[model samples]
Target chain A: MALQAGKGLLLKADPIAAAFREEVKLGLSKTSRRPRLVGILATSSAPSKFYAEFTRKQCEDLGVEFILKKTGAADTGDLGEGEGVEEAIIEANEDANIDGIMVYYPIFGVQQDHYLQQVVSPYKDVEGLHFKFHYNLYHNIRFIEPQSLLTSTVPSAASAGVVESEEPPPGTVKSIIPCTPLAIVKCLEHVGVYNKILPYGDRAYGRTITVINRSEVVGRPLAALLANDGARVFSVDIDSIQEYTKRPQGGADTSQRRYHPRHVVHPSNASLQECLAISDVVVSAVPTASYKVKTAWLKDGCVCVNVAADKNFESDVRDKASMYIPAVGKVTILMLLRNLLRLQQYKAVN
Target chain B: MALQAGKGLLLKADPIAAAFREEVKLGLSKTSRRPRLVGILATSSAPSKFYAEFTRKQCEDLGVEFILKKTGAADTGDLGEGEGVEEAIIEANEDANIDGIMVYYPIFGVQQDHYLQQVVSPYKDVEGLHFKFHYNLYHNIRFIEPQSLLTSTVPSAASAGVVESEEPPPGTVKSIIPCTPLAIVKCLEHVGVYNKILPYGDRAYGRTITVINRSEVVGRPLAALLANDGARVFSVDIDSIQEYTKRPQGGADTSQRRYHPRHVVHPSNASLQECLAISDVVVSAVPTASYKVKTAWLKDGCVCVNVAADKNFESDVRDKASMYIPAVGKVTILMLLRNLLRLQQYKAVN
Candidate 1:
């Protein structure tokens, strides 16, 4: 599954994603009905259209139901941009047959796009962008009673407090995490970045990572997920650098509290060079083609991951990094499918 | 307002809370009806009973309506612990006359009490423990459309994005923050810990803070709040230490995103001495009387705030600190009342 380059292993998303694909297939085989996913495309954007087609191909290959609902400029040439997106989301929300809903983003940019995100009911939101899921993601509320999604009450004793097990507790299910972040976590797990011997929530302990972006969709949430899992994360964006960690200077007594406060942030004044010098792993998602992480700055033998559509690492990245994952897109799609399956189960339980 | 002690100036909550008291009084005077708050005491715990009395006196002094609804063990000799607490909460939630609801803690300990917290409607939840408000606090969604509370959609363009203004955007209101955290922020603000000259939302920029204790109700949320406002906050709980910050090493390009990802967490292996040596401010809320932050470890001229009922700082705290605040109980009560006023406004708009 690993391709050895001149200096280090160059990894692709296929092998990591294949493992999840099998899991999804097995999940689908056991389900009573095929899970249906509705992808809403409302823009004339090239990337979004390509993504929609790509999603359709993946869904078709997996034998899951895929429906593309194009509106506004993406529809017939006469419509305005992002027009009828709300109605499309509402229709998908009301459709009992639709198990999951996903919207191709940047149709109207951040704020408007965020509103469209919320309009998708949390019950069927495959993207996991709804505020309910986002809240859980940020707070590290990993498992929840499926019934709690419909009502505020804790349905049973099993759902009373945080359960440390990876598998959901009795009468509870794993809360949906954002697909991209989940994909990234899965990638880290595949590459031995996550230490299995360590405790469940603190698998990334002792690792210092630098994630070069703070976009809500990927970088910020990914940083939070890693930090919550016990990593020292340097979240780099265009303006400033912030460090994320679960264990700060003085370790707290675990006996008193029911759950660990997931992670905390500390403003770092260190330069990119300083961060790169110390980082055990470097993940760059800078979208611009012009942006490149200097190979010379990276810590030798560190793992590197490039999440951008455009390569964000220099030609000689392998000279320093022990391993480099070119993209996480394939794994991300598998995560989306996985979420769809989970949402179906959620619906079934409710 | 500041009394010169043996070394540092002693700061009291009286002056700090007094300012907020006038603001609440003024807000009450302008309202058409007096704001009514219901405090549900369901425990025989001494602290809870004392706190209820304190809350009543404060409400009476401010000419606000206060109702003590004793249920379970606190009500009479016959009732079991936490009995009818959920019913009491539901009653307060449905009562048109009740503007806010606050339940005394440790009624049934962590999990059952957490469920009881969820039972309080967000509309009347002055304590801000409801998952909805906690979500907003953790995500740094400072201003929300008042109407957005009742519905999922954004009510207007004004409430679409994060607004940096201290004043709520038109048609929006400041999302309620947990009382203890808000009280700490206010204390920091009163003592000039918040730099007014800086841009809004980042007023705590460039300061390093250590917050001891990460309880869900106080420590964890306070750390998030401070970090969101651009302070580097070290969140110390019993089992672990976490660092919180909005800015990392390589700054994000501000032009690319609508809002900064509030804050990210990093697990630090640093000892308590290391954190204290660099911290510009130290706020401790450790509840145990035996738990005392060593004064000798503090950074010279640092500000110290004690938020626990029993002082968590050593007797010699003033030796190293430039300013010492003994307690924030008064400030926390005021913040609760302020939340009650805001909730009333929230109801009026809905």
Candidate 2:
């Protein structure tokens, strides 16, 4: 089954293009009084090139200022014999003219810790990955994370739904579901699949979801969010789960059985096949070069979501499958912009 | 197949009783200071008649003094009547010369809330039912609640394990497990069942456990405790589970076929039976004149825990059950004494 599954990018060419122009027009009116300078710092040419071009064009149309700062893909000199990315970050942090600063680390292997600590001021750090922000999350304090912001922008581009245009507005909260995973969940809901087993005709209850990852940016907080929606959750580390089941003497009792619907993390090609074979819905976040799921592994009507942009689609049963979603580019940027507008409105009122 | 489960009781019989006797002993040692006073307030004639005679004999043996405050059987207003009990409670609360105060309310429709506020001071509210103490529970602030103190007394005793100990050792943060339930859980543990489930098992991990009530004093907190111990929990109210599931159309996809092992709640006897039939372990807190569970309903070798004191045992099932545990009195008293002693030690050190 060649499934059409991937990230769902709700695109509106005319309306979204017009909305960007309108935001720029409104933003430019206030620029003379307080120059709204957006800053971009990136270690890779790819992300920097993409964001800089996109943001600069929007800024120009809105009459807002855009500044691009490139810290070439190299290690900080203090850590090794290489260019100092940390030094560039310090410069960005001290720049009084910058209204908002974004640092992009495109590849997974890059070590950005030193630069992260040195370059970002809490107020200007639009990503919200600073130590202070993380500590607040640990204590269950409410604060926006940059990833959440970036993920909402694309969905906000669609013409305001009836609920969106209600009095006082529904706020960005409803529209701000996690881009990749929420896209998968939304697809399931659209196709009359509510929860894992039961289907709701129209109104869907928030389904109990288990996410198996604890990386600072994704796993823990996502589990908390799912649990807050009345979902009983079990979050396990990928390595720990493997180690738990591989133990000698028939494994520990904890790994003996699966009694509930489970979500596994960053499954390998083989593991993905096993998970897809049993799951009603499968979501893959691993950045791979090709499709991990095989056509035969999925249940006939299962939903498959692929968020790995670099991955190629390959599945014989795609036509026979229920639905497949494809990944979209710069989806995070759209989400971030929507979040920024909401935050601005909140700050204005509160 | 009749299995008798071990049960334990905790009490502060040694030190507090010793202290009472010591006062009497010291007063009798002097001819001038021989007028030692002891008073009793009884809502039931049974305790008044029995304990009154016992105290009089103890006083006479030490050649001290004794006094009895009797609300006589005819004037023995219904314990469930809040106004009448409150009046007696206020009288006890104001009596200055009384060394210690004891108020007994029978289980026969006693309105505990009616007298609780008027009868107790934080210090002398030996029963720990006072508003200030109960409110502390809401904020998770620790204060003595007399009933909790009394119920915990038995576990405190059983924890001694046949050792004739007078006082708990200093600096003990006593684990005051509620006696009847603790005994039941411990009994199961002793039989090597649920041994793999540790003290800190996360119920969200999906172990099916059904608790038959949600009373904070017992059912709800115990459910939370079990869930914390890694058991998937199903809590049912004794009165509602049947009607909740049997309503015409079983509104809103409420079929047993949709039951997930994660967790469920049923509040009627029939639904509780359905849950029990499928459950690995069943905990009953339902107040019934006779056994609510029949031998046929239980799976062979299933663990049945009865936390209700008044439920009558049916001989057929009671004999064939893998385990049957009886409620032991005075455990709560032991738990309270240990807590008080531990508090005293901490106060001294800190």
Candidate 3:
């Protein structure tokens, strides 16, 4: 994908998502029964409705069973906002046939919506928002025994700081990563941002990237994922700009070191312009329509990915950038499906 | 506390620890029954034994019930190393009389010892090394309902992005912080590192700190705690230098931000010299006896703290530092006692 004069390659999520889609289809084909997914839509918001429809279409295309459980205002205006969301989640959690569960967020906004996230059983938590998964993700514990979830004890891998193999250990499986972050990672990998020869855990080493927005679902985890894989991630949020990295300078003796420096946060005073000036990749997930990444500030020939519903980059972003991916929704959906397939297998062993 | 020519104030842990010891004593006075803490010592290491003895004396002086449960090598030379530790933890978990449980770590080194950490019940986890607490710590969830532990849910505060009050909500209590990190924060607060005039969560704002070592027990959590409290923390480890910070540069509109910008990780290329030059406070927890912070590299008038059993600072560190705290062990013990009291209340409510 070479850039044209004063224009970059406009990349679509289709090819990246399509590869994962095939993998999910292959996973579904091996399953004894079609995996079932329950999506709880508690709000009448347009985005939620659109997402539910999109999920349904994807599920139908892949031959996976998907049920959209619309509650509260999403179902009927007569019902209170976010009403019955908890009950719906409980019902889905109890249904052994339901291999995965996803909730359309922002129904009751931040706090209550977060509470609803935890309400979903970890076994069926396809979104990977549950605290258990979050704990593993943040700590960089990549693999876990599915049966261990039933036990109160967690994997000691995070504390152990051992260099883990890409392959899961005996009787263990890859832990679920949040779909959006996973999607972003997969997209980056496809674009050759993750150097394949640079070892499994630190594949993105030597790359400095700036991620705009530090939202829990996307920005923060994406920053963590990239940093864990050895990218310098500038985590741009509303009030702060934090740098995330797994690399430490001026190395000390590591013989007795207990914990691997998993993506540690550092305070940065660098402005967006400063970050963009040096960034090889700039990913913007800032949701608001007004937010825009100035093309002039971007590093020449950088890769720009727009993750928000509205374009976070200016119209001329591609003019300076080597490649621009407008959205990752397709890749995210496939990642969710992949998680659903994994959860099904997880349920089988447990 | 004026610094002498070519020397700085040598601050002792006793004075700072004494203040918290009284607070713990006051908390103990209110309890109808003495809070019982079971210390599981599975390691025969000299340091572990010394720590066990230290904890016993502290508990004895404070009028709290302390029981030392020696297992494996700590008990019998014939027994295998780390043997019976899991069983001992299970026994403590079942004991209604035990308000808290703490294990002497490195029993079987990092991995197995971490597994032992999880074996200790969250309700009885005085060290706050449990995944639940670690999740809360990494994500900056300051409070949780005690009864919520019984359920599968977690605090939504981290995802909510709301500016939390210092006081826990009506039905909730302050979540247990890892004792060592809490002690460090308390010591900093005592020495005027934390600004009382600032809002509750971001007290360590406007400070740049360098924490040597990214060990699970001390260095990592301490960095997270400081960064979450609004300090720019550079987490220095054997192989990497990562920046930890809550503050972001080039602020965005916060109207619909779903998650508060928690302590974020950024990869830094800075050497120890560079970090020390800019840092207002320098905390070293590097375990090796040979490793030392060069006296000449430190920022002028910086507060120096040594958390390692072996001093990490050069003998002449005080020449440039404003104050130097050699150890926090005494303060850490008080924090443990405080957690025990809190756990007692947490258990009662649950």
Candidate 4:
């Protein structure tokens, strides 16, 4: 195996995504009103805090105003800090200059993320994590209300919550897809896989992708995102990997339909090895500290991404693959910031 | 292959779903306040009208109030009938007596459905298509707020849109899954698969299912639902099914985690036949009218549910399968009505 120590295999959103950001920023710079963003963290989780700080710095670099709302135990109170968090979110929602609002995951050291998310006006929900962003996803990005320069993915402002509004034809909305999923897409584009073979940049057209872990925030959404691109996605559990691999040679197969590619393999080494032997791409959402990635069965050309902070793959696992993205977290921040920039510019254009 | 006639194959709701619905209905009947549901259709499509009428009849049978607001050409007048449709939905949402609100597809014709969906308050969104329903899917059905007996998947109401609500522990919330997907799950359960093997009552654990469409409404959501149940799902397209089956089979395999199990097959009739030979379930969300299902390669005992209205499978094809669901539409309406009953009862309990 040609194990080049960090040459070209580690994927990053470079020329393509960065170029897009520059273009969006240029348009935004010409606008009189600068964009401002808010970051709300309700937890003491190191990862959440780290991400919030990362976002703050990114905002500064982009010349966007960043607001930080941190809620702790006493502040949240015994009844739960959800109320206090709600008040802060509502305040930001009412802020005129606020162009985007994002909550670090596990809001308030708990999974209250969605509760606080709905409070932020969809107009500023550049992350597209809000429910309105999802509702609007049914419509093409063009129909998004309070329209600015829509990203063609996130339903723009004007279309937000306008239920009675006319909808574009089906198969048009690109899904104001969540940030992390979009980041993966951007990475695929960075690798020249998107706009080449597949649409979501997973380079997954006619390809098979295996996603480890079934997370609402990452694993499932990532699988859904890839499945949208006509690729076959396999889902498994972290604790039960070996068992899934040995169970059977064949698992479930969907009708090339978008929602049909999640599978919990019969955790058997044979099944695991079987999946590895036939995979085109693999995503490790949960850190596999115990699993020996180097000995894992996988195609030599398989592309991989590790989204978790803890490194799952062994040192040589990266050696066997064609490419790997060690920077999914950073890419997520960059992509989110870029989306915000594009959205702000879209608002200006409107 | 031995094919059973109309005797044992067509899959429909089993005793479980019916039993659940009956229990829900019993609760609703006991409640002093009758559950009132409203159906709004903005098109003349025979299908839409038929569905509305079917819903109305079902409501009558269940002892619930059903209201039909049909907005056609004259009422929706040009500009895509978006404006007029919005007003009607808003009115319905504001109605205190309306327990649930549903909109037949093609609100102003040509899939302009979302336009009419957003105006219905989340509280009345019985269809479970709303983003609020989706975001709130994280909460247990019991905790659904505003004291409405929320459907299990949609999360109850009092905490509806409350941004600062307390967060439930992760992975505890049972998804208030969409109606159509639930219908398929029920069919699986009816066929003795769900609880027999899978917890979703679909016997999906370790099973492989091939979904045949890329529908946002049916295919993707169905895949997600099955993924939640730990089933191995393969997604594919109607046109390129053969080609996909022929693609090189080394897909990207994930770590022994969950949610990554989509595979592109080698596509030999041998391979397609192999998948069908091994599959436990198959669902065709869209009508594969052009595709011949008679000569289609499949196993004998594979249970199938065709969600599309068009008869994709030839008459003879049904003769070979262990079970098939010919009544997806009927089942969908039944499940939705049942959900309304459940929600009303849940509301009463609150």
Each candidate's clash count = 43, 56, 22, 102
Q: Write the per-residue lDDT of candidate 2 for residues B288-342, one digit (tens) a residue.
A: 6664666666655555566665543344444444555444223333333322233
- Over A35-100, each residue of candidate 1 has an lDDT whose tens digit, in order, gives 999999988999899999999999999989999999888999656667667668877877788999
Please report, in order, the local distance difference test score of every candidate based on alpha carbons. 0.81, 0.40, 0.82, 0.56
Q: Report the lDDT tens digits of candidate 4 across residue range A1-350.
A: 23466533655545445765576568568767777788877655677777787888767877777888775532344323232455456667666678887876664321235445554555566776654454343221324334422221222234432222235334332235567877876676567555463332223556666777765456655665564444556666643332111111344453443331222122234355676777777777674556544425768878877777776666666656788776576667766766676566545545
> For candidate 4, what is the lDDT?
0.56
User: How good is the docking of model 4, by CAPRI class?
Assistant: incorrect
Docking class of 1: incorrect
lDDT of 4 by residue, B243-268 (tens): 12111233645444333222212222
Global Cα lDDT for candidate 1: 0.81
Candidate 3 overall Cα lDDT vs. reference? 0.82
The DockQ assigned to candidate 3 is 0.04
- Residues B238-329, model 1: lDDT tens digits: 76777888775346664543334577666667788999999999999988989999998999999999998899999889989999999999
Q: TM-score of B chain for each model?
A: 0.93, 0.50, 0.94, 0.73
Q: How many Å off is the CA of B282 in candidate 1?
A: 48
The digit string of per-residue lDDT tens for model 3 on A1-350 reads 44577799999999988889889889888989999899999887898899999999999999988899988878855565566776688778877778899999886544335545656778899999875676577668788778766544345542423345789878879889999989989999999999999778888988999999876678877998888888989998776687887665337554553224577666678898899999999999987999999999999999999999999999999888989999999999999999998888898886
- Name the regions of candidate 1 deviating beyond 4 angstroms: A1-5, A151-163, A250-260, B1-350
Q: Which model scores highest in DockQ?
A: 3
**What's model 3's lDDT at A175?**
87
